[model samples]
Target: MRRTQLRRWIVGAVAIAVSVLVFLVPFAFILITASKTTQGASLLGFSLPDKWVLWDNIVTVLSDRNGLLVRAFVNSIVLTVASVTIMVVLSAMVGYILSRRQSRWNGVITFFVLAGLIVPPAVVPTIWVLQRLGLFKTLPGLVLIEATFGLSFCILLFRAFVATIPRELDEAAVIDGAGPIRLFFRVVLPLLKPVIVTSIVVQSVAVFNDFANPLYFLPGDQNATVQLTLYNYAGGMAANQYNLLFADILLITIPPLIMYIFFNRQIVAGMTSGAVKG
Candidate 1:
């Protein structure tokens, strides 16, 4: 018993050490660097700022290029909300259908869904298609791209969780004269709280933090997402504005970090529910 307890304690300590080194340490470094002067941050040392100016750095970042950072934040919020909403609704409907139905096409549909997870997006082709559709460099275009890219994973998550729900509820709903839409919305969706929260939190982070997609699909300054606005500090004054750059990174990172912190338990529960057998 003593040996078992000692081993558990050692493992727990090791995990804590790893977590601190991996997450907390890098965050501390960012905080310290973001607090420093231009030359101090340019040095990129992990030590504390000689003269802390964190608020000034934050203000400069926020007010730079006529409040570009503010615009980027609004664009990101809109993109994340629209993309996640589309993903949740469409994926949930598809997941419910896939879970409840026993069609012969299930295997083929499943193959394509799995393929979506495996296949790297063809950027050039996607760009060409978007241009043809008059959506390139548009927020709506980028929203669609984000939604499409995230849909497969969300579908799989919803599908797995849907399987855990008893079908007796479905039968009862149908008996009560509920239509297909009514059945799903009134019955299944409410019970999908865990997976819905999981999908929203996970996909919101991904969409908000997405750099490559917005860079490729939405190029204009007018449509800049928060991640793309990082380039504002990368040229001309790059050597002198590392502090502002880090401050911008810190600003954009906070929303997703707060989401994860608040929903950590729900994420674990949702993921575990999808993992175990119904």
Candidate 2:
């Protein structure tokens, strides 16, 4: 028993060390590079800089192109908030219905929802559809695209969580003269806090970090997002403003990092809370 215990302890220690290295190494490199001069950052070595220029890099990134970085921040925030809000509410309602209903069409709907996970989106076809709808190159169009791509996953998460909720709750709400909307808002939504928080954090991070969807669906200089600011700092083959690029990367990365740090426990609980049946 003692030998087995010692072996387990050694394994756990090694796993923890590996995990730390995996996260810390890249983050440390980014931090070091962000603190260097443009020439120093171009070297891309792991060594500490002789002269720290972290503040200068940040100022330059923020002030470039008459404050394009600020505009990108605003665009990213709007996109994330709008897309996530719509995705969560719609997915929750759909998931609840799918979880409770036993109709024939439910199976078909479920199949399609799951198919979204398996299938890749066709960009050209989507662009054509968007153009026909008069939504091409619009923020609302990008919001819809983000929501559609995320709906399947969010619905799956909510459906599993909703299954773990007892039907008695619904019956009791009905007995109290609650309608569908009222019941969902008052009883079901309150109970769904963990999963909701998980969805919000996960989807918010995904939308905020999204580069391709914004680039393809909402292409415009005025519509640039935080991720696109990287291009501004290091554009074309000749441009090599490594210091500003790293600084921009670090700034954009901090929000999601803080979100994960704060909501990590909730995310774990939300993911696992519905796994076991009572």
Candidate 3:
């Protein structure tokens, strides 16, 4: 018993050490490189700068192209907030109905929702549909696209979480003359706080970091997102300003990273809570 416990403790310690290095090394490189000059950044090795210019790099990135980075930041915020809000509410409602209802159509809807996980989106067709709706090259179009693409996954998450919730509470609410909307908002949603936070954190990160959807559905410099701003700093035919690029990369990465750090516990709990019950 002592030998087995000792071995397990050793393995756990090694695993933790390895995990920290794997995640932090690259981030350390980014932070160090972002503090260097263009010439220094080009080295791209893990070395502290001769002269710390982190603030200068930040200023350059923020002030570049007459504040294009700021605009992209605003666009990303709008897209993330709108898409996440819609995804959470819609997915939760749909998941509740699907979990509670019993019918053949329920299986069909469930299949479609799960299908989103397996099937890759058709970009050209999506663009064509957006154009037909006169929503192409627009922020709202991109928001809808992000929301729709994310809906299935969110629904699946919410469905699993909802299944864990006792039906008795829902019944109790209904018996008290609470309508569906009231039952969900007053009785169900409060219990869903953990999963809701998980969904928001997960979906917000995905939507904010998404590069392809905005590129395909909402094309144009004016509609650029935070991810697109990286292109503004370094791209084909453009002189690669590695320092500025790293600075911008670090700046854009902070929000989602902070979110994950803060909500890490809720995300884990929410994902695991449904497993035992369902």
Q: What residue runs in model 1 are displaced by over 4 Å at the alpha carbon? A: none
The order of the candidates by lDDT, greatest first, is 1, 2, 3
Off by over 4 Å in 3: none
Clashing pairs in 3: none
Report per-prediction Cα RMSD to one decimal: 0.9, 1.3, 1.3
lDDT of 2 at 227: 92
| TM-score computed on alpha carbons, candidate 2 | 0.97
Q: How far is 178's C-alpha from truth in model 1 (Å)?
A: 0.9
Give the per-residue lDDT digits (tens) of candidate 1, residues 1-278.
99999999999999999999999999998899889999899999988888999999999999988899999999999999999999999999999999999899999999999999999999999999999999988989999999999999999999999999999999999999999999999999999999999999999999999999998998888888899888988777574688988999899989999999999999988888978965
Residue 34 displacement in candidate 3 (angstroms)? 0.6
Q: In model 1, what lDDT does residue 74 have?
A: 96
Top lDDT prediction, candidate number: 1
| Model 2 misplaced regions, further than 4 Å | none
TM-score per prediction, in order, is: 0.98, 0.97, 0.96
Query: What clash count goes with each model?
Result: 0, 0, 0
lDDT of 2 by residue, 1-278 (tens): 99999999999999999988999788889889999997898888999999999998899889988899899999999999999999999999999999988799998999999999999999999999999999999999999999999999999999999999999999999999999999999999889999999999999999999999998898877999999888876779626778788899999989999999999999999988878652
